[model samples]
Target: MPTEYVKRVLAACVITVLSISNTANGLAGDTKEYRIGLTSVIFADGTAFVNDWRTYLTHHLQAPVKFVQRQTYREVTDLLLAGDLDAAWLCGYLYLQHRDELELLNVPLFKGKPLYHSYLIVPSSDTKTRKLTDLKKKVFAYSDPDSHSGYRYPQLSLISAGIEPKHFFAKTFFTWSHRDVVNAVADGVAQGGAVDSYVWETLAEKDPQLSRRTRVVSKSPEYGFPPLVTQRGLAQRRADNLREALMHMSSDDMGSKVLQILNLDGFTVGNDDLYNNIADSIRIVEQGG
Candidate 1:
């Protein structure tokens, strides 16, 4: 049984869902409406990009939809588990953490595959770096405590190399977004940092100023990619409709425009097995790795 708090959250969620269903279903005559929700691990700008993506989904599904910006992955998962979020864009590790509560609508595609890596980075001019051990006692920035590549994967990488972030660095901070982590190192606010290598690579390849300021110190082994997910209890037909909308987003469509803004190629269908490695890593971290 869910706890009292979970029950309360679930109750609120049911109310919201019922209200939306009544309003949208009333107009549909016989068709169903899916109040799809979108959540991302990025900051406000990333949230806006997702909102644009949702706009395309709404048009494609011919139903009402909404997107919400989550400041942290943990918060988004909480909303998802409580049934407040109909669907979300989640990191592999985050999804693994709440595997029972949410299901993947599909995997998001970047340049290609449904996989990416983490990067340990320092300013290009910082001659004193080569490996994770080199940055011992240095100032470091992470995106968030719950972030996959940005925090968890990088933390695990350090542990694998025989260092725990809480004890290894002189001091560490979370910049809360991959872009800011890069900026922090570039500005010398941090001597080094960890970020999603994909975000870093995309920014460097596309944004000259950012590329000029930072350099990759190391990269983690590849892991499952981030994905667009929906709550587990969502109606199957509704989920399928949402998936179809995402999977078909082409360069000639609204998804294309949103993808252009988001620097993504598009989305693909996925399942829970994609994040097994993330679950393994979580166990490693929890066991004091």
Candidate 2:
């Protein structure tokens, strides 16, 4: 069962499923409406930012921007696959998992690069613990099952160290939000956790008191940042327009403000090579490389 707090948050989210019959005739001209899915992770712990981003995008594109929110990344991906959404910003892991079904659009530039890391963290008071092995038999919090940083990287670490992830941790739980994973560690609900570095760093900048309660034990090698993607069959011109709007955001005042709120430098025309590391990791973990 979800906590009452999560229930409240979920209730406020917007998720509209529209059919082709409802949008096809109206999407091409000046009134083009773009329905985009924002993965749960990108909600980034701020309603104000999400609202501002929607307003900016809607104005920039001269169209209605519908942000579809789901509680999980998988749900957002499903919306893309089902043709209910025009495009979505999803985790890199999901990109590789369904590479053939989704087409990459744009990748956000963070600190001038299109890359981020997985953070391994523990409560600040656990100074004696230094690495993954030190957390053996302790409780752990994971962000999401479909998240590479939150779920896959930690499991990969365990396997590389020759430890069984299932038996090594005394207990584990999924917080469904990377921000919540940090909260779980800081609050001592979990002694250790795996979280997205970008999310943690953003929180560290915006809320030092909370960030100070947890210490980063290690960071995974850099991986491509999460990216915007359209389904394989989306119209080329439609995808191109959305991609152009994102890549040009830094030059526009309102778009610049939205970037500041999200703490992203800008968006880039990132290529598949950016996610090669992730694809390689998938092979190593799945094929016993």
List model 2 lDDT by residue over 6-107, tens digit each.
Answer: 876766552222434336645546455789998755636367777887788887677788888888888999999999999999899999899999899999
TM-score to true structure, per model: 0.85, 0.89
In model 2, residue pairs whose N, Cα or C atoms come closer than 3 Å (at least 3 residues apart or on different chains), thus clashing, are none
User: For residue 118, what is the lDDT in candidate 1?
Assistant: 85
Predicted structure with the largest TM-score when compared to the true one: 2
lDDT by residue (tens digit), candidate 1, 1-289: 5699899999999999997887687566424445444433432265566677667877788776766566677777778777776777778877777777778888877778777888988998897788878888889999878778888986777677667668888999988778889889889888998888767877876786975688888888777787878788987777788788878886547778877776777777866677888888898888865
Task: Mark the regions of model 2 whose C-alpha exceeds 4 Å error after superposition.
Answer: 1-30, 43-45
Alpha-carbon RMSD to native, per candidate: 6.1, 6.8
The lDDT per prediction is 0.76, 0.87
Task: Evaluate model 1: give its TM-score.
Answer: 0.85
